[model samples]
Each structure stands twice: as structure tokens, then as C-alpha cells.
Target: MLLERGVTDAELQAEANRIAVKVESIFSSYLAGSGDGRDRLFEAMRHAGLGGGKRLRPLLTVATGRLFGIAEDRVIRAGAAIEAIHVYSLIHDDLPCMDDDDLRRGKPTVHRAFDESTAVLAGDCFHDLAFEIIADTATHEDPFVRAELVLEMARASGPNGMAGGQMLDLVAEGQVLDMGSITRLQQLKTGALIEFAVEAACIMGRLPPEARTPYRGFARDIGLAFQIADDLLDHAGDEAVAGKRLRKDAHAGKATFVSLLGEDRARQQCSILIGQAIEHLEHHGEEADLLRAVARYVEERDR
Candidate 1:
């Protein structure tokens, strides 16, 4: 069962699950003490943010931070902030005007579970909360570090990043795109925040900008690999296990890595990317075992 460095696939899943639980708790605490007719908004936010996720971005944050001996709790808080942004994006992405998904994580999406307006508000609140958490001293003791986290996270989630990618995706619908265009879209839409997850750790660890090049490279590779795996999953993955409507990309006429590249070739490319990702960590020791395991998990994950 051992994958590498005494880490197993099951162990990676367990850790992801554990991070999910911890993130749920953090979300609960933050959403608590809400009053004054905001209960429904809070409820919708909880429905969107609380349960059922891989928490991969947070895991990357914690794993990379561990390389510098950062306290787990500190990194977990930062990771939770990143998770909030992720949840916010998902909530909006599932709206009627967006992907129009009804199911997510084995249940009705926020818009389906609640109402559209409530879902929009919930997503908005989660976006606000992400920066609030990162800005607070509780996430990091250094004011400079907190500011940097906020700036990087904002950039990752802003127009030049996820939002821009989403726009590109919407525009690409029904249009045939070359591999370069698809790669650019995925890099912005999916890869940016993923890269930020690792970058946040380096920032917290006080690693110089120059020293973060390898980690950045690792993040970029894994981010693309993760999206390719997702496209493959959409191509043929089971809906029941994915807990969401599958084949939406194909149905929407969106060009994905799988759509442009054959499934076999996409899988092969994913393996290559993952290999490159792990090689980026060659300078590190076993302290990076979790990251290596994460890269493998990204390649092998079914959902």
C-alpha cells in the first residue's frame, strides 16, 4: 500500500478528509454569531462551504508550509482561507447563468438547495470572509506576511486569474480551441489559485521570491495535471462517485484537454506533468513526501 516515503494512497485520502473536517469546523466558527435576518444567507453559505470536498488547495498549503517548520495550525488557518475562496468560486460557478449545475459534492448545489439570490449572497460572503481571515493577525503573526497573503489571494481570484479563466471558458463554448488556448484558459481558471496555495506557504515560510521558483513550477504542473485529470473524469467518470453531473464540458461544447487530446494521450500527458511536478521537489528531502503524494493523488484521483 505504500506509495512512497511511507505514505500510502489511503493515508493521503485520510489526510484530505481530515483537512475537510477541520475546514468545516473553521467555517462553522466563522459563520456562527450571525443574526439580524442573515440566517438564511449563513445557511446557504454553510451548505456551499461546509461539507464534502477534497480540500486539495488547503492540503498543498499545509504540506508546503511543513517544509519550513511552520506550525500546522497556522498553516491550516491560511489553508482554510484559501478553501473559502474555492468554495465561493464553486458556489458562483454552479449558478444558473454559469455552469447551471444542480448537483455538487453529492448534494444539491447552493443555488439549487437555497435560492439564486441567496446563493449569490452566500458566495459573496464567502469571498469577503477569505480576505478577512487572511488579513487577520490570527492567520499570521507578521503583518507583512498577512498583507502578502491577501495580495496573492486577491490576484489569484481576480480578473487576471480565476475570473478571467471563467470568462474564457464561457467564450470558448461551441468554439473549437487549440491546445494553447485551452491551456491558457485552464492555467488562469484553475491553475492560478492552485499555484497560490503553494505560494502562500512560501510566503508564510519567509522563503525569498527567488527561492520559490521550484515550488511555483511544481504548483503549475500539478495544477494543469489536476485539470487534465478532471477532464478525463468528466469524459468517463461515474456520476455517482463524482457526486456531480459529469460530461458537462462535452455537453456544453467546451474544449478541454480531453476534448482536444484523445483520452489516452491526455492521460499520458497528465503522467508526464505529474512526473515533472515531483521532479521540482528533488532538492527537498522526505519533508516533501506529502507533496509528492499529493501529485500522485492528483494523477490518480477519480473525482
Candidate 2:
């Protein structure tokens, strides 16, 4: 299917990798100018921000923005904001009080690489920096679009979105949750940012909700598929390639799509979700080829 549109999976991967590099550079440059009295916090921020990850959210933002003919620089700036917020969440999530993770992106987590206090400050700084980037007029000439982007990002990452979901996850620890409950949990925990990634493109383009509604649906399906893939990877994926601890959910006795649906069923559900996600893009032209490949790649990716 990807080949028919002249968009190969490799090409899509290459595009995402390119975006990752761009975002890393943006972050590195942003932290490089830190003055005295806070160099360690900035260093921790650079470590967490520039360290390798899939940068999937930024890719989604950039790809969707490109579809609307937004300028590459503007979209890349927005992508950087998305990645900053994401890395910030990762830093906090790895804190001793949180997930207590020691490894991330094949290196020691921010807290492990630096002191816990510095890691906390790094996460806080990145969180603040995300909005600063989006709010800057340089991200968009129009003030309204920049404001909308900031507001959307706030909702996506604030109590109603990722943070709220994390709170719920903390409370639900070691407790059995039903499918509906778990779905809602994962939607908020992981899906909110993914939704923001796609919807931010609409804001970047100054497009109305009616125009970007399909992409929202696309984000919804892909978000769940992405979580399911994560669960599957955690269930059986190699920790070396995954670059973190695997089977933590199972060990913690947390219910996941893989645990609840079984590996085969969870895999089948991912296929179904990807199909639906692709369906939402039918109204788009070949320009949306990258999104289609992204959907397929999420299903097939090993890390």
C-alpha cells in the first residue's frame, strides 16, 4: 500500500529520523547558552532532551503541518515544543517518586545521570520552555495561532490530559481495572500528547476544527494503537532494543491491553486500529502518504 503512493516504510522512517535530529539540535542549542549557577540543570535538560528517542510526536506534528502547506521552520519549531514537553514528562516519570526508572534511550535517566534535584529542575524547565517556544511569534506570524497552540498544549499536558492520566495511573497501581477504565487511562496517559501532535498542526495552519476533525480521529485510533504496541513491546520486546526495562507492567501487576487481550488479540486490535486510522485520511491526497506510512509503521515497529 505504501509503495503504490511511492512512500516506502523506509522513507517514512527516514523522515521521522530527520525530524528527530532537527528536534535534538533545537534542544541542544536552546540549552547550550545556560549561564553560571544553573549549568548542571541545563546539562541535565540537554541530556534528557537530546538523547535519542523515536521522536514520533514531533514527526506527527511536522507531517500534519506539511500537509497544510505550513512553513517548515514554523512547523519544526512547533515540533520542538512538542518534543520538549515529551522529554519533560519522561524526566519526571523516571523520578524516584514516580516510575523510578534508571534507564532511558539507552542511557541513564536524567535523575540517575544527575542529582534528583537537577532532574526535577530540568523537567520543570523543559515544561516551561515548551510553552515559551509555542508562544513565541517566531513560531507563527499570527498571534491567534500561537495562542491557540499554547492553549491546546496546556490542555493536552495539564490535569485534564497527560498529568491527570498519570495521577490516575498512580492510584490504580496494583488494582485491576476494566477495559473501559484502562482505555480511558491510556488515552489520557499517552494518547493526549499524540492528539496534541496532530491537532497542533491544525492550529499551526490556522485551520478550523471541521477541517482537522478527521486527523483527530486519526490521532485517536493511532494513539490507542501506539499504546497497544507499547504494551506488546513491554510484554516480550528485548530490553536492549527497547532501551528500558521491559515487562514492568506485568511485574507490577498492572493491567495492559496485552495482558487483558493476550498477545495475539492485542496484535489483531492494533491492525484494526491502524486500518481505521488510515480510513480517516481517505479525504486527503498523496501528500498524506507519510501519515499512512506512520500508521503502518506503528504497527510494525520493534522499538
CA RMSD of all predictions: 1.7, 1.4
TM-score of each: 0.97, 0.97
lDDT of 1 at 181: 95
lDDT by residue (1-303, candidate 2, tens digit) is 333544787798789888888888778767885578788888888889885899999888888887898876789888889889999999999999999999998999998999899999999999998988888765545888888888899999999999999999999998999889999999999999999999988887888888888989999999999999999999989999989988999889999999899999999999999999988887778888887888888898888
The candidate scoring highest on lDDT is 1
Clashes of 2: 0
Local distance difference test, candidate 2: 0.88
The alpha-carbon root-mean-square deviation between model 2 and the true structure, to one decimal in Å, is: 1.4
Q: How close is candidate 2 to the true structure, as a TM-score?
A: 0.97
